[model samples]
Target: MRLVPTPEQRELRDAVRSFLAAASPMPAVRRAMESEPGHDPEVYRRLTGELGLTGLTVPEERGGTGAGHAELAVVLEETGAALLPGPFLATTLAAILLTETGEKEILAGVAAGTTTATVVLDGNRALNGAEADVVLTIDGDRVLARTDGERRPLRTLDPTRRQALVEPGGEVAAVSAAGIARARDLFAVAVAAEQLGVLRASLEAIVAYSRIRVAFNRVIGSYQAVKHRLADMHCTLEQAESIVRYAAWAADEAPAELPGAAALAQAYLGRACFEVASGSLLLHGGIGFTWEHDAHLYYKRAKADEVLLGPPRVHRARLADLLEL
Candidate 1:
């Protein structure tokens, strides 16, 4: 597939890149990671309010930018490149699900950057835990959940996006159960797209490092072993990109192939991202292990995101089911 983004999409991408370059540079990212919350809320507000990124997929009727998943994918790709740390993926995914199901009240705060919400698709059996004002749960074919805030500490590798254990017991809005399954599948695909960005950034960092780091009077990149490793990374990165693009396009244009495509993208990209990030770190040698280096940050995030929505094994199984294998 050509995957040619529209002019508007290109503009959005460039704008986001420029904004991050100035506001959330690598130094800022490192500073936030070491801070108490591990993120700067002010930076997030600027992203939503100034850049209008928080409302990318929101409906115009509900005070959103009214963009779609394709646009969101572009934003996420940039976020990954910048190694943005926050509740962006969680909040965006939650907002998308809520808006799609006619939950308009939630939009006002989310779009305004007042409400910070994240989907709890991590270790818990439930949809999301105490942090959410609303929980969307899938039971068989029925989608049911209530509003309540129950919080618990989670051991997380990526402090950029905090995790919570939420259990809400209150009035719940019920949607068509079938739709819940579809929404979960779509969210999985969106996550895979984001992971592709991380993978790409990691690969680029490795290549840049190899070209500069010298060993025995020659750049390490000139070594056949290093060259071969980079070759494999490129192959995996391209493959991951192919599936992510296909999944995003399928979500927006080809709904019939969505479920299968989403599963394929998630399974492949999740594993491939881990490999790429890990390789990037290894290729950087000891510096990658240090706190000052940016390589470990990407490695941590890649591992975190791989299990964010679901594990690779789970998605692989879903792909098999979708294909009737």
Candidate 2:
């Protein structure tokens, strides 16, 4: 039997999907990408306020609904499919890791939708670095928060999501090696979930388009080659999705499996999602390459997200090492 999401998880996924379809359609995503802070404040507020999503994973004491990482994974998947911008992933990671550090005040603010934060767990930059109220980073075996710094935006492949270089500042929190590893694992799972959404969305878009796109008086989807490629993409998406679910579940119920599951998902889903996005564009013919089309956006996001949690090879190597290869 295949592992599947529970009925409640399905409901949450559908709600987020419906909300994004209306609030962050292609035009809205394009506008948000061009605007400063790279997200719609109104939509972000609605996500946290009306949906109470900001508090989805945070405990009740911290003003959150006290849900688990699985619920957050559902939201992340929808955001990925919608290409919802801003610091959603960053803020979620911060809440999870900071909670482990006993940062209750900050977690409370996060769940309340009043404060947004991000962590530069690796490298010199942070995802969603430019628009966070608080930025956490690693400095010489310690986790520090910036008292003062500036974000230098980078022109990445995906405009829907923003990336920036952040300089470190005063030490705000001290986290152990274990905490750092834990945070990184959780972050990887979130990234994997988003990529999973992209994969699924790409297949759906291509499938729908193929059915209606006529070529030489024949629907493009009726062609055998097109059918085979789409079939392969569907297989990849389904397998990668299973891995992503396992990773999310591991984060909540089985800590021993988290590292392996996260790495496997990251390694496999990165390239798989990229292929699906690229394939969707190719299968759509010339129209897919145009800027006015959303295919390019998905392609760009696929490439960017592929490298976000470390590239495919990076995770592949990690997986091997984790397996004692």
Candidate 3:
């Protein structure tokens, strides 16, 4: 995959950004978050049926486009920035794990967006647990798969993405753990890419507000304090984006570097995303702090995502171990 966005990747990014801008604005996000399945099925259909993004990474033999991580990264960033309430990321995770473990049957349904799958992290919590057609987990040394059992949805800070308690079900099939660990590292990279979008959205929100929101007879951006904070946020956003891009590139073009790159991405981007979002909220003042404000949505998502793939500390530790420190 290219490090800099090729013309096609940029086009895809713009298209996704534009589509989400129209189809799932903050109001739509709020509405979708409150609805069952936590997203609009029609919107999801367009994303998969029209755009063919759900299978961006699955092989062509498995009904996918045979695209790479860069494509997935592009789509996810746009979705994350827009706070689209969908099971996209979770479904992608399931696709990735199945692809990694060579489970072609399950991968085909996932790639076609005909099946929804969720990952049970422990016995306790599930990532995108609600409204899934299948549930998968790493049971001891084997990868376990089963039709979803009764789902108990949990209220999470990020309403745009739901979590739940996925109860145990009868067995479906088992697969080898050939690339499961690598798949997880790649998943961290994927999560960090979304966080990159969240941080970028935060900075853009504050900057746009600062230019117009008047305070003391001048735009807030005129204040040196606000300028400095925005500058810091921009710098941090750049770093997060850089690491995430490298992580994605490594997963595709440089397999040997993926573990360290993925760990580094999660370690840095996770915390930076939270800081940028919280800073954006502060810059927006009273309006941003309100319940109806969109700033809180990004802020809450940043907090949740910091630990969604794995916490910053855990990734940092993994980075250290990978580097043999």
Candidate 4:
């Protein structure tokens, strides 16, 4: 498998990074977290209408660009790094389910960014469910769609993304168990890629702080304790990057291998990201623990993401099951 991103992918990454750098900086993230919709509609519009990212993994006939998971992974990495707060991730996750179940009408709206959605996996709670135009619930051997749902907001570790308890009250449809499982694996890879972004951002923040912050007449980065921790975080970042990339590639190229790849990615990345983000917070000293600092936000995001689909331990158990050991 190729370990490097192709030139086109690199360009895509750069474009997304640049757009986020300008539109969704840390201050913007803070604002978005407090906004009623929980995100910037202008930014979402630009991402979907201008950049056409929501359509990255969707098929051409489905009103998408027909790109594969590799490309989607790149965009998600940028979004994660920026700590983008919205239904973008939720919408994308919904897209995966729609694609798997062949839900053409809603999928087209999702691809065009006109319709937002979230999947209810935990019976009642769903990520970004409050603002979603479409709510999909998996009922035994079927996927149900509801335009109107009894949605009540729920408190969450990450306020950047809203969660709600939904009672879907609309149409019923059929979906295969195999399709659901495949969609789940693809979902794992997508979230892993995003966690990888949080990991990278946390490391960069601490490293930058270490250079400027002085302690005992020297930069903290010069100390062995700080340097060692930074090194460990870097190593963790590298491993998470590899696993996420391989899993994303598997989604596009090797369907049979995707299940295992997806499991490994989440198993490693979930914990690795939380550790690095927590480290970033700790290393920033008293300032990091404060609400005003951006470190806490990243830390919260890492923790939230770790449990969003399930924790690392859960994925580890899944990995063991996949290996039949």
Q: Score each candidate by Cα lDDT.
A: 0.77, 0.86, 0.85, 0.90
User: For model 1, what is the error of residue 63's alpha carbon versus the real structure, in angstroms, after optimal superposition?
Assistant: 1.8
The candidates, ranked best first by TM-score, are 4, 3, 2, 1
Q: lDDT per residue, candidate 2, 1-325, as tens digits?
A: 2257889999999999999999999799999989977999999999988898877878788788988778888999999999898888888877877776767877788888888888875586777888888887767557677735788877777888787888877765777877778778888898888998988888899999999999999999999999999999988987988898889899889998888988898899899999999999999999999988899999999998888877899999999999999
What are the per-residue Cα lDDT tens digits for candidate 1 across 186-298? 78877887898899999999999998999899999999999999999999988887787788888788888888988998889888999999999999999999988989989
Worst 10 residues of 4 by lDDT: 167-176
Candidate 4 local lDDT, 88-200, one digit each (tens): 99899998998888879999999998999889867688988988999998877788888884889999998778899998655555778888899999989999999999999
Candidate number with the higher lDDT (2 or 4): 4
Task: After superposing candidate 4 on the true structure, give the runs of residues whose Cα lies further than 4 Å from its correct spot.
Answer: none
What root-mean-square deviation over C-alphas does model 2 reach? 1.6
Question: Which of candidates 3 and 4 is the stronger one according to TM-score?
Answer: 4
- Candidate 4 TM-score, C-alpha based: 0.98
Give lDDT tens digits, candidate 3, residues 86-155: 7888888888888887778878888888888877765657777877788888765467776846778888
The TM-scores, one per candidate, come to 0.92, 0.95, 0.96, 0.98
Q: Which of 3 and 4 is the better model by lDDT?
A: 4
Badly placed stretches (over 4 Å) of model 2 are: none
Which portions of model 1 show Cα errors greater than 4 Å?
Answer: 123-148
Clashes of each: 4, 0, 0, 0
